[model samples]
Target: MALMITDECINCDVCEPECPNDAISQGAEIYVIDPNKCTECVGHYDTPQCVEVCPVDCIPKDPDHAETQDQLRAKYEKLVAAKG
Candidate 1:
């Protein structure tokens, strides 16, 4: 599943740099995760780096954008291809 940054986010700014996909960005209030670019680090790492470094524990799977591991890998591949 794609991860989301909840309202509970403290905006300490650690999560943005941790995203391998460059999906996390500054919102009006808190950092936001772009679901289209989120793969939960499936093709990049064993665990989502943002979630791993998040001090507030505000990152969670987005039920609204649920995806399986295979789906995430496919997304990651697509993203990588697009970059090249």
Candidate 2:
């Protein structure tokens, strides 16, 4: 599943650079995660890098963008291909 930064986010700017897929970005009030780009670090790491670095523990699985491991891997592959 894709992760989301909630209202609890502190705007610390730590999670943005940690996302391998470049999903996290600054919103009007807080950081936001692009579900289309988020893979929960499936293809990049064992754990979600944003979740790992967030001091507020605001990053959580996005219920609206629920996806399985295979789906995440496919997204990761697509993102990589787009980058090249």
List TM-scores for all candidates, in order.
0.98, 0.97
Which sections of candidate 2 miss by over 4 Å? none
Q: Could you give candidate 1's per-residue lDDT for residues 1-84 as a string of tens digits?
A: 899999999999999998999999999999999999999999999999999999879999999999999999999999999999
Clashing pairs in 1: none
Tell me the tens digit of each residue's lDDT in model 2 across 1-84: 899999999999999999999888899999999999999999899999999999989998999999999999999999999999
lDDT of model 2, residue 42: 93
Cα lDDT listed for each candidate: 0.95, 0.94
Q: Could you give me the TM-score of model 2 versus the true structure?
A: 0.97
Superposed Cα deviation of residue 43, candidate 1 (Å):
0.6
Best by lDDT: 1
lDDT score, residue 27, model 1? 97
Candidate 1 lDDT (Cα, 0 to 1): 0.95
